[model samples]
Target: MVEWFVGVQVVIAVLAGTAAIVVGLAGVKPNDYTLGATLLVEALLVVQLVMAIIAPAFGNVATGSGLEFWIYLVSAILIPPAAVMWGLIERNRWSSVVLGVACLSIAVMVYRMSQIWFVQLA
Candidate 1:
């Protein structure tokens, strides 16, 4: 788990969340720009996933439950695409709100992933 990579993920999450919220508040339907932001964040998640998979080979094992970490990783990967699909189907301002919530959820999951990687309980 690289600290800098997690930091970049956090920043992307924030930006994605902000974009979604602003679009929602403006009462606009989903647009390509908003969807693209979510897609970009998703792409970053893929990078994070790959890094996590290989981190153990470099001797960077999670201090917390490995199962939990994997669960969070899988959920993080699914969220953006799910939200985007729902938005496209719904075709309303609420779709933007859904995207906002999804982005925020991804941010939380990323933070938890870091905790699982770096924090150990005695």
Candidate 2:
């Protein structure tokens, strides 16, 4: 994983998640703003997926378990679309909250992936 890119992803995820949560709490239903934010997060995850596939070819390698890193990366990539689908189907304020929850979860997972790429084990 690219260190700076990981930071960018986490920042975007937090911002998007916070916005979605606030919209939900205000009783706003799933709409363009919320859905768009979720999509933006998903787009970033897709970029991260591509980066992960190619980074090693350029000499960047994970210091931790490759399987663990890939698992977290793949799972994180899946979350936003699932949340967006649920939001589209439900069309409710709680769905917006669900999107928020998914974004926040992705943020945590991305951070874990970064650790698996960069952190040293004993």
Candidate 3:
């Protein structure tokens, strides 16, 4: 995986998480801005997924189990859309909280993915 690409992902994750948290704390239901931010993060995740899939062809193989890394990537990509959908269905402040938690989870997952990409397992 590309280090710079991973860095970009990290930054996006942080922004996404922060946005979610702020929206949640404001005690509003998921609105256009929150949904848009979720979608934006989802878009970035799709890009990251594509880059990850093609990285080995470009000779950027992960030192850990490829399966584990792919699983993390796929999970990360799914979180935002799922959270948004759930939030829309719930239609409450708790929905915003759900988005916040999902975003935070994505942030941690991305960090773990980076470790999997750059570190070798014994």
Best by TM-score: 2
Q: Give the range of the ten consecutive residues with the poorest summed lDDT in model 3.
A: 5-14
lDDT of 1 by residue, 4-95 (tens): 88988888888888889888989988899878888888998999899999999999889999888999999999999999999899999989
TM-score of 2: 0.96
Off by over 4 Å in 2: none
Error of 2 at 73 (Å): 0.9
Query: Candidates' TM-scores?
Result: 0.95, 0.96, 0.90
Per-candidate clashes come to 0, 0, 0
Candidate 1 runs further than 4 Å off: none
Candidates' lDDT values, in order? Answer: 0.89, 0.92, 0.82
Summarize candidate 3's per-residue lDDT along 4-115 as a digit string, tens digits: 8777777776776788778788888888877777777788788888888888898888988888988999988888989989988999887877887787788788889889
Locate the minimum summed-lDDT window of 10 residues in model 1.
113-122
TM-score of 3: 0.90
By TM-score, the better pick of 2 and 3 is 2
Best model per lDDT: 2
Clashes of 2: 0
